[model samples]
Target: MEAYVTIVAVAPFFLRLLKLLTIVLTSALLALPVYAASSPEQTLGLIRHTFRSHRPPPPFVRYTLTRRQLTNEGFPDFIWTYTYHIWCRTSDNAALGRRVFRGGSYGSLEFLRPTFNAATDPGPPTADLFEPAPATKQATPAPIFDRLREIGGVEALGETDYQVLSAVTEGELIHVRLLPRREPERNRLRELFADRRTYELKKAVATDRLFTQFQSYPELYTLTLGAAGGYPVVTAIHGVVDDSTFDEAARYIDYTFTEISFPATMPDWYFEPSGYGAHAKEAPQ
Candidate 1:
């Protein structure tokens, strides 16, 4: 009888020990980097692939962005949602947005057309249309740049600006952590994440001055891409936004691309804006 009781007690202790060991082992595996062979070529290649733009990426996309403005008390106070149509190019990007609501608190916001592309617009402006190419080197548009930053398009950052701190495979996706080579780059772009096989950018997080150029603030960006028309188009974005022109408190924003399409044709006001391709009505058609 005494041996039976002792056996039961010892069995429970062993089971508890086994459970503790399992947790530790699982955590250790997560902490360690998965290696295939002598070199990490696969991981390195994936990083480089996502940094650069590839062919077949759609030039136009339309998405609904939801901004949940949070208070210092950790409560979502103001929620702003808008549907935006953006045309992206190497040198130009344009977007037009209208207010949408989840509950009923839609505020007054006029979205200017997006015209800055982080992948290339960070450099000097393109040549003038009416004048000679060298005669006019136009200044970079500040608002366009802000739109790019707000939307989590930080791929324009050069490779030399950052170093791959660590990379781990989580299921089929590759999660990479990056650090700035210099302290200055941190103020511009702090982090980036991308996919390997399709060469689609996943996330671009940064802390930089934007919009009205007040001061730099933290931004966490999550991005998603989908295949459309046999090409890649940004499907979604989850981010935190706060800058000089924005609310005092940081806001959690989500950009969901409901429709991704290219303009079949242009209209009479084709020469109105430099980056805009089609009007709001003609975009989805």
Candidate 2:
């Protein structure tokens, strides 16, 4: 009878000990990796890997683009819609065909005619009737990935020109902030947010400042991407060029892409200006 009483008294204590041991083991199992929280280089390496491993879409891609500019008071000042055909091998050579322009000085029915350019040509011809031959040199719009790769100093993200400031996990995304290491970079800051599971860039923001004539002008650019047909595609781009120093309000532009597609086959002449047939015309002046 005395031995039985001792056994009953110690049973509760043994059960409590077992519960405490289980709790400790469970906490250890759920702990995050030490390097993930403390090492910024590792995070950068992962991001670079993800970018390098990304498979670009097929050679041919076509989409519709809608661009709108908003005034300082948030009113639409200009609107443009166009069908874009691009050869993915070289995105710099794209055709903005069947364009429609509205707002600003353009009347409701003032639509710019369709235009196309040859792959070997520098750019489209002048839309103005009185303009000279061989259009003047102008900046051309580029794909988001191309722009990012250029700004980040080629395919490597942590090159000498770029400095990774910090990286941290926030909910379902990994946020990385970077800065330009050289004075000539003109970039003030760059931030990238990627999906935690896939490490694909979901959004990116960059700021740049340019000095001209003893004055400084700041510009901000943002890009957002969405997954389409198992590939990450740029969905929207917004930019603002601050002109407050000249007593002019900031100019805001928003460009959105829709109906993105990657066709299996594209004719050789599709990229040539002559292939546009009767629709081929000069670019807007």
Candidate 3:
């Protein structure tokens, strides 16, 4: 009878120990992705996979974009809102748009580009306005990915392109620091923060060495990403350009993506420059 009593007393303690262990194992499994990345390559692969898997549909996509310019003191100076209608083929991209300017000398401007065919064009493809203009030529609309590739000179993330400095966890995000391996790239140093669970890029800051006629200045670019149509999309971009040669205060520009979408169908003539003038009245405001 005494041995039976001792057995009953120990049974509850054994059950409690098993329960505690189960809870710990479950928590560790849930956090596997956050801690799984031991090196920069693995972290980069996760980001690359997210981008490739969430790529927008091909042929054409239309969306609205809002851009704002801010002063050095963080006051808004200019705001422009516009609709982007773009069509793309394997080798070419074309766009037609109308922009309404506000918060400054308010006005509206309509513009169209016929083609940015890679086969015959001298410059990179122009299909989106948010793209930064190349130094030699004027600003034009181009696909974001294409512009990034042209500027970064890298089609995909590779160990040779960046040297990872460090990775750390801050709350629910993993922040990583990296430096460019090559010169003349806009991304001289970059700090990227991503979601711990999803591994999606949340924010990034890039420091670039931009040169003018007299000297070089460190231009800082800040980017913020958010979810759009189940994929991470750039929601805001701000840049501070240092003025080393001139005594002028630093130049600050802010670009915001207020609206974005992937339209199902766009008319045939919408993509043609010759036909754009005729269809200006029909374009979405």
Task: Give the TM-score comparing model 2 with the true structure, all chains together.
Answer: 0.57
- For model 2, residues 82-174, the per-residue Cα lDDT tens digits are 323233322333443444333422112112222211112111211111111223222233333332244445554444545788888898788
All candidates: TM-score: 0.49, 0.57, 0.65
* Regions of model 2 farther than 4 Å from truth: 1-38, 72-74, 79-92, 100-158, 183-189, 207-218, 245-250, 278-285
Residue pairs with clashing backbones, model 3: 126-141, 127-141, 127-142, 128-141, 128-142
lDDT of 3 by residue, 1-285 (tens): 999999999999999999999999999888767436667766755654554555533545444445445544555544322323223331234444555544433223233433211111111121221222333323334334542232356454345556778878789888878777665242343777888877777887765444445665566767777765565556666767666442333365455655555555667665566766676667555
Candidate 2 Cα deviation (angstroms), residue 102: 9.1
Model 3, C-alpha of 251: deviation from truth (Å): 3.0
| Per-residue lDDT of model 1, residues 149-202, tens digit only | 112554332344456666665554556666656654232444445453443445
Q: What order do candidates take by TM-score, descending?
A: 3, 2, 1
Q: Each candidate's lDDT (Cα)? A: 0.42, 0.51, 0.53
The deviation in Å at residue 112 for candidate 2 is 14
